[model samples]
Target: MSKTLIVYGSTTGNTESVSDDIAKILEKNGHSVEIQDAADISVDGLADQFDTVLLGCSTWGEDEIELQDDFIPLFENLEQAALKGKKVAVFGCGDSSYEYFCGAVDVIEEKAGELGAVLLGESLKIDGDPEPEEVSAWTESIMTKM
Candidate 1:
């Protein structure tokens, strides 16, 4: 079974809920999973214990992309996470009406790429409320890549 870590930052709980759903699906699939709030996690060597790392952060800001408040510190110190050669995936919740919908996901994906992390699948972006089926499907897709 793959050891997975899911770290998420949420303000309104949308992203957190999505993170929970993903964790449930992964666990049910026989993967060992750990879920954490970004506010409480240290980015240093974050991915070392897990075979795969998943990041979830909601986007804020009107004209530009702003990662969730609690995620700012983690995002800034992402290099310390030692993501190079690790399997990584990005996901988030956002409103489609926003100018840069799910912008946080895009930024995380780019940063992961720069760190030479192997991306498992396309980033999952849930517009508005998250649906369990959609989240499960996305998790299953990532599982296939593993």
Candidate 2:
């Protein structure tokens, strides 16, 4: 079984809910999983213990892409996470009406690529409320890569 770590930042609980759903699916698949709230995590060597790392954050802003408040610090210090050649996946929740829907996911994917992490698949961008089946499917799709 793969050891997985899910780090997420949420304001209104939407992103947190998605994280829970993903964890449930991964656990049911027999993967050892741990969920960390971005506000409480230390980015230093964050991915060292996990075979797979999933990042989830919410995008905020009217004309700019602002990562969820608590995630900004972690995002800025991602290099300390030691993601080089590690398996990483990105996901986020956002409003589709905005110009940059789930923009945080795109930002993270780019950063992860720069860090040389092996991205599993396309990042899951949830618009508005998250659906259980959708989260499950996305989580399952990445299971193959792990």
Q: Clash totals for all models, in order?
A: 0, 0
Please report, as a residue range, the 10-residue window in candidate 1 with the lowest summed lDDT. 137-146
Q: List model 1 lDDT by residue over 48-142, tens digit each.
A: 99999999999998899999999999999999999999999999999999999999999999999999999998999999999888898899999
| Structural similarity to truth (TM-score) of each candidate | 0.98, 0.98
Lowest-lDDT window of 10 residues in candidate 2? 127-136
Error of 1 at 107 (Å): 0.5
On the 0 to 100 scale, the lDDT of residue 17 in model 2 is: 98
Q: Which stretches of candidate 1 lie over 4 Å from their true place?
A: none
Error of 1 at 31 (Å): 0.4
**Candidate 2 lDDT, 85-132, residue by residue in tens:** 899999999999999888999999999999999999999999889988
- Choose the strongest candidate by lDDT: 2
Global lDDT of model 1: 0.94
Displacement of the residue 43 alpha carbon in candidate 2, Å: 0.6
State the TM-score for model 2.
0.98
